[model samples]
Target: MAQPHDAPTAAELVAAVREFLERDVLGSLEGRTRFHGLVAVNVLGMVERELDLGAAQDQAHAARLAELGFADDAELAAAIREGWLDGRYEELKSALLDATRDKLAVANPSYRS
Candidate 1:
């Protein structure tokens, strides 16, 4: 029950998550404990992956967009870059949902990516 003002450091957060999963989720499970363990491991893996490459991913995406002649005013550039950094994942998620809906209308519709 740590407040926002008591924000944990990265290591502390990882440890806390591990402890919670072990004590609350996995500890109570019997037959499905292995599945829960796998889920926990996958979650930790995803967190580690993001921590390792999040900045580099943003920089690479921005550089590619710049190379593609996406120049704009300073304010526009800042806005676009911020969206590219933070919103790309959400945008892609929405687009995927839309594509699935479109597929229901027509079989095997072409997807951009």
Candidate 2:
């Protein structure tokens, strides 16, 4: 009997991370350092989480845009999708913040008080 190929174990992931840290991060360092190993492990975990949720995040954004009438036109929908895929996170966040501020200004003219 053999284990299923689709089911990957935690130990296997840990071993792969260890090997990556040793070969890529640690090996690139000029001297023996623990910081690079720790950083590599942390980054690897972050990347794994992002990979797992990236599609769901995009879908959620697309759905929200459609609900908000942002996707009313095919050209607009395509532009929105392109902007999302090409835009930086910080740029998107800042744009959202500005839009919120503008909405608040229109809704509450006395907000300055």
Candidate 3:
């Protein structure tokens, strides 16, 4: 096995591959192939964004969940489904919206606009 070095992080490696695909492979393709290549590049971009933002988003999600008095999504969902959190609908909605925006920021920042 090869030893791991810290210089090129996972995000960096993904970005390098994404750049290569966009610069070299994408320009040579046409029609459906080019479309698929674009999709692949977009997926790689999402991965890179996730690598950069996932940790902070996760922490924010957990904090939101905790603020709502739940341990995890399942618990929160159960409470909502059971109508136990009906009185806190606004609070829940705010938390959910924040979480969704965080996800959108990583998946497609344009969506937030």
Candidate 4:
């Protein structure tokens, strides 16, 4: 919902555009154009999802990274690649799985099925 006079929120605007593309534009395209339109629709859908879920997911991701004793993804990856987390495999795997699930929840919820 919008905080100012119930005006359309950014997420609502993005959803509207995505829906318009899906309903009106995609069907009118041909070959490469249609393919590109489909990609555009998918991208818009992803954007809508991100707008809705990004904040909470970002917090969860940050917590996971902190739990792994890292400052960020780069640090976490470096630790893993350098074998620093070798002995913490299960812990690392659980945190990674949680992060992946959060990502999929926004990117493609059906993928987990």
The top-ranked prediction according to lDDT is 3
lDDT for each residue of candidate 3 in 1-113, tens digit (9 for 90 to 100):
12576767788899999999999999999999999999999999999999888889999999999999999999999999999988988998999999989989888999995
Clashes of each: 0, 0, 0, 0
lDDT of 4 by residue, 5-77 (tens): 4658888888899899989988889999999999988888888888888999999889989988998999999
Query: What's model 4's lDDT at 30?
Result: 98
Give, for candidate 2, the lowest lDDT window spanning 10 residues: 100-109
Better of 1 and 3 by lDDT: 3
What would the per-residue lDDT of candidate 2 be over residues 9-103, giving only the tens digit for each residue? 54457558867786776756654367767666666655554445446655655664554446534654476577743545564455455544544
Off by over 4 Å in 1: 1-8, 15-30, 70-113
| Each prediction's TM-score versus the true structure | 0.39, 0.36, 0.92, 0.89
lDDT scores of the candidates, listed in order:
0.54, 0.55, 0.92, 0.89
Worst 10 residues of 4 by lDDT: 1-10
lDDT of 2: 0.55
Off by over 4 Å in 4: 1-6
Worst 10 residues of 1 by lDDT: 103-112
Ranking the candidates on lDDT from highest down gives 3, 4, 2, 1
What is the RMSD, in Å, between candidate 4 and the native fold over all Cα? 2.0
Candidate 1, residues 11-109, lDDT tens digits: the string is 467767766776777766666776868587557645644555556655654554464345433543575567754546665455335534433323322
> Model 1, residue 32: what's the lDDT?
75
